[model samples]
Target: MAWYYVENNESVGPVQESDLHALSQQGKITAQTMVCRQGDTAWVPFAQAFAPGSAAVAVADPAGAPRVSHSCVMCQKSVTADDAVQLSGNWVCATCKPLYLQKLKEGATISGVRRYAGFWIRVGAKIIDSLILMMVTIPFQFIATALIPGANDPKAIGAVIALAVVTNGFNILSNLAYQVFFLGKYAATPGKMVCKIKVIRSNGAAVTYGRATGRYFAEILSGLTLGIGYLMVAFDEEKRGLHDRICDTRVIYKD
Candidate 1:
């Protein structure tokens, strides 16, 4: 039998069973080390492969390194080596370990390093979204205007004001609802979905409806700044506009 293990975030090859035992003896493999054999669908902990009675796998830190606790890079909780998980050279306590593992299972890195969306991609998505919004809102507007008997009559000024107010109010509320619903539920608007982009927190968690709504409003700041805030996406490394930064959200390319 041969086994492979993950080291420094890279998979190290299929060593023979004897080599596995040798590596175990050399303190190179630990209980937390992820191991897999040929034809295995997923990795397993080294300790699980050889249970206590079947065969004792020496997974202890035999190097004489102190058993003292270290702070978890994620939750900042103190954890001993036995309850700590190492990923990309950082220690994460058991309390925060499952989140990273789940991310890995979802094909995202534990550190949440994703290829961020650039300015032009985001702009195109916005354009598509705007067109969709127009398609939804414009028809109702035209119908309302046509149904009004004196819409173009000079003497019907009051009716014209009422219609304008109703149309603008409907547009505002509908747009708000559309944005909040999609961004919160799917982390992307229909247009963003088409563009293969999603909105996520810096930690790679889904953005809640409250945060999504706030992010939408914060976009006003981008316009208030004469579009400089929006253009920040072009210049910033993460391609975040001012609104994204203010809301602690990132727009990224989802695989």
Candidate 2:
């Protein structure tokens, strides 16, 4: 029989049942994805429809009107759309609505489907960022040195000291601005983008400029601890570094 599935809250297609099974195996259709066969009056979950010896069940409203059931994005319970609330484009049944709202208020990832980035991958991204920063700072260092009087005079200790301080300050501010702007606006630096990962809040929301600034400072704690903070990702259940834990952030794969 031909089958149809819901994707991104829209009905997808009338493909052969074999094709539907292929989609499910390929991870294109999740167990909770709504599916219906041709001429079916109601939609049911892929698991319910395909379970061994199970048949798709049609639900009817109390007033005897035909109704379609959807899986709650939070609790995974079958609920008719009329009885469920939509939050951020995902469905939550009446039973889970309160808990879902509480999670939202507390800034937690409601669905918990994020794939945390591992330490090695994070290190790779950091290396890339460092290289980019080096490229930017090297030129600025040359320009600053050329502009400063007596910069090339080995005897001018005070002038050399002043140049060093100015150069270091510029590097610090530039690094901060780079991280804050990218994390706040794109949720990833160019390095993280190349690595296909991004930083987000524990709630799965994009990082804000203020939070990004704080997180950049928090990373200093990671460095101060002799890199133990970053090492935490290798052992932590959520793959969180010290900065991630301190800032309540996560590094997760984009896909």
Candidate 3:
């Protein structure tokens, strides 16, 4: 008996040869019916291919219309109807699609539950680190003012330039160094280390620099509006900090 494999709105003939005969004998298929074979990329039938619940077809649509949806690639969340968010060539649920893409753009790993440092501790450490950075920056700012000639003119441009050269750079560097060195080595920042907390990737891996930046920026968004955003963490399923959802990151327990 000749067999056919159903694939991509089309049918190709002579699949496994034996599989078709077996299906035919079992009454699971008929000459005018459509079915699929094992080890085949898709389902095919004597007439057309049918996905999981579309079996008892009453009409000969012949087009093998795809009325159902596939699961999401990242969260594996199912999407049934047409209104679902389609991302990365798969059907992703509404709540997860935006989040998943946010992380992907930032290159976050986003795998499983992870440990995170307490909010207060992180805030405090950033303060101390920023202070130290300021100390290092003031001297450099004076040097820059003398070197740039117009750097002292407080017209916003020069001031902004001076700030970027001195304070802003140092501040950013300080935070980067603090998070990367601490989190990479101990899975915690100085504050997190002191607070006995740590940040972890969703998959139990050490948080990477890229993901850390995403989460940190998300923190900025969460804090820009009177801290109402941070409160969203308490309501989240994984207890995500504002940064977690945006970064596709999470904080979990070390022990």
Q: In candidate 1, residue 34 scores what lDDT?
A: 70
Q: Candidate 2, 242: how far from true, in Å?
A: 0.9
Best of the candidates, TM-score: 2
- For 110-145, candidate 2 gives per-residue lDDT tens digits of 554456899999989999999999998999899989
Candidate 1, clashing residue pairs? none
**Model 1 regions more than 4 Å off:** 1-112
TM-score per candidate, in order?
0.56, 0.58, 0.44
Candidate-wise lDDT, in order: 0.78, 0.84, 0.58
Native-to-model Cα distance after best TM-score fit, residue 33 in candidate 2, in Å:
36
Alpha carbon lDDT at 57, candidate 3: 42
RMSD of 1: 13.2
Compare candidates 1 and 2 on lDDT and give the better one: 2
Clashes per prediction? 0, 0, 12
lDDT of 3 by residue, 201-226 (tens): 55445777777766666777888868
| Global CA lDDT computed for model 1 | 0.78
